[model samples]
Target: MARVGRYDSRTIDKIYTHVTKKMDDNILDLLDNL
Candidate 1:
């Protein structure tokens, strides 16, 4: 049970990092356009 929880958390962290990075890129693009 503990191992499964750890694995799930790791997966979630990866997804969160990916989403945040994409958002940062989009924000930068908008700023550049302005």
Candidate 2:
């Protein structure tokens, strides 16, 4: 397997965590409105 520069696992995990956190916050807001 070839190392593809700076696009590593840690960066991917950070992005995934950030995205999931945003989604969770949105869901909570929607639920609160109901």
Top candidate when judged by lDDT against the true structure: 2
For model 2, the local distance difference test gives 0.87
- For model 2, the superposed segments whose C-alpha errors exceed 4 Å read 1-6
- TM-score, each model? 0.76, 0.80
What would the TM-score be for candidate 2 when compared with the true structure?
Answer: 0.80
Per-residue C-alpha lDDT of model 1 across residues 1-34, encoded as one tens digit per residue: 3655656776888888999999999999999999
For every model in order, what is the number of clashing pairs? 0, 0
Summing lDDT over every window of 10 consecutive residues in candidate 1, give the lowest-scoring window: 1-10
lDDT of 2 at 34: 100
Candidate 1 wrong stretches, greater than 4 Å: 1-7
| Ten-residue stretch with the least lDDT total in model 2 | 1-10
Global Cα RMSD, each model: 3.9, 2.8
Q: What is the C-alpha lDDT of each candidate?
A: 0.86, 0.87
TM-score of candidate 1 against the unseen true structure: 0.76
